[model samples]
Target: MTLTEEFDQSLLPGELILLESAKLFGATNISPNAKQWEYTRKFPIDELRQAIQRGFGSIELPQIFGGPGFSFGTKMRIAEELSKFDLAFTFALIQHHNALVRVAELSPSDHSRELIASMLTGDLIGCTAMSEPEAGSDFSSLKTVAKKVAGGWILNGKKGWITNATDANVCLTYAQTDTSLGSKGIACFVVLGDKEGFIRQAGYELHGAHAAGVGGYGLVDYFVPDALVLYAPGLAFKTALQGVNRARIHVTAMNAGMLESSLSIATQYGENRRAFGKSILEFQGLAWSLANVATSLEAMRSLAYRGARQIMRGEDALDSAAIAKKFGNEQTLSGVAACMQAMGANGLRAEYPLARHLAAAKLLSYTDGTVEMMNERISGAVKKRYVL
Candidate 1:
């Protein structure tokens, strides 16, 4: 049986249908072109537009906003399915969808509403910018400053390591309005990329996952009207934290999906390739290695599902999300390597995705939040929960 069949019984019929469609979309559009995209570092804009046309761009957007309004659990499953084929494209798609959701639900301006209409059609792509050259996890230390003007705010700073930064036309930017208040001084604004002062920086040449369009940009005297403010200083930082739990869970699901793909490829090759007058599967050592990978994949799925359930129930998922991300970070890196080893020399070939998955796995270790950050978060709760 396929890996998804093991858990299909637990999913709702509608969710299953969505998953099937996502799988088909990946096979038709992503898997075939992933190698080429990586080699040339090309952004998959056409495929991204197709995905938006098919409703992947607004999975969790409210029905009132003309979106399918799928549950958060379903969204997580879709993310997993798409990621199995290509994590770079899947990550970019998720970021765009999130930007759409933020504008649709949070922005009160008519200009934002018009942008949402364009985003839904893929005419305009969107992204969030939070990281800077001097600040990553340290949100309170961001140097980007937003000075209040007569009509709105004048933003001046640079953002780095942002997903979809190379091609996005609408940016949800975060900047500090006051230095003394630290994190509380942070605010979020809708900055149009085509405007005068917003400058798109050169894209990064990543070791892998190039389709993600990961890059940075600079805002020099960029002006955002008061109507475009999504979150004021007092609430912007908290809003960002609230989204972290879901983001962590999404990354965990992606790791699980990649592990599943790697295990399947390695297992098939081991069963078919003969060595020493017999299939490699006959060797106890190789069989046990794949078995361990399978076990880890199952555990990863369980943690991802648990975290997703917590978010669906509107419970505080900080601990669960941290645990899930930490476990995935440790297992996926080693697990994919083990799968690559099982195939011997063939694993390193460009035809096989194992090498790519390996690099992406390392990259993901630093995505969302670093493994060290996860440990720091979990350590804070250890005494409260474990001592009992």
Candidate 2:
């Protein structure tokens, strides 16, 4: 049996159906053109719009808001299935879905009613901007400033490493209303991309994963009316923290998916390819290497689901999420590389997804949170959780 079939038996029947649907969606819509999108550095806007029709645009939005409102565990499963095909494209979809949830749940009813509708229909794409040129992991150090003015606030700053930046028309932007108050001074605003002062900057040329549309933009005196504020000072930072656990778990699932894909490819090649007058799988060395990756992949899957379940149950998941992300990041990077090494020269070929998966594994290590940041979180809780 395939790795997914063996590993996913723990899922509920309904969740399995959704996962199968996501698998089919990725195979039909994303897998075929993922290489081309990477080669040409295109964002696959049309395909993402098609994904919205398939119910991928609003995975976490409430049913009242016209979304599937699936549990957090189910959403992570779907994310794993999609990421098996392509991490960059899957990440873009996740970002868009997250933005939809943020707006529907946080924005004022009268202000977001129409905006949410357009987003669901894919007429308007969305993204969140938190990291700036000078601040990423240390978000409190962000220099983006928002000054209060008549009728609205004027924002000025540049956001970098944002997903869907090139095509997004609606942005959830965070700016400091007062630097002295640090994180407490941060505020979130709905900044329309078409506004006069919103500047779309050129995208970054990464080594791979270009379908993410990772880019940056500048907000030059961008005016956001009082009605557009999602979180005023003293509340925005806490709101952002509330979502970090979910984000970390989602990224862990993606890492597991990528590792699964790479291992499957390498295993298939080892079983079929012949060397020294026998199948390469006959070689004890190569076989054990692949076996190690398989074991770690299962462990990563378990950690991902554990964190997801905690969030679903409304339990404290900060430590679980950090541990899962930290383990997944370290394992996936090494695991994908081990899979590639098992394939020899064939692994480097563009025809296989191994190369792309490897690059994506490295890129994902920094997403959601970095390994160092995860370590800090886990280390802080070690004495409290372990001593008892």
Of candidate 1, the 10-residue stretch with the lowest lDDT total is: 1-10
lDDT of 1 by residue, 1-388 (tens): 5435655656678777877888899999999999999999998999999998888888888887878778887778888888888889999999999999999856556786788889999999999888998899887799999999999999999999999999999899999999999899999998998998999998899899889999999999999998888899989899898898899998999999899999999999999999999999999999999999999998889899888878988999999999999999899999999999999999999898888888888888888889999999999899777785
Estimate TM-scores for all models.
Answer: 0.97, 0.96
Model 1 residue runs over 4 Å out of place are: 1-13, 386-388
Which residue runs does candidate 2 get wrong by more than 4 Å?
1-16, 107-110, 386-388
Q: Candidate 2: give the clashing pairs.
A: none
Which candidate number would show the highest TM-score if scored against the true structure? 1
Task: Using lDDT, give the best candidate's number.
Answer: 1
How well is each residue in 267-331 modelled by candidate 2, as lDDT tens digits?
A: 99989999999999999998999889988998898888878878888998899999999999999
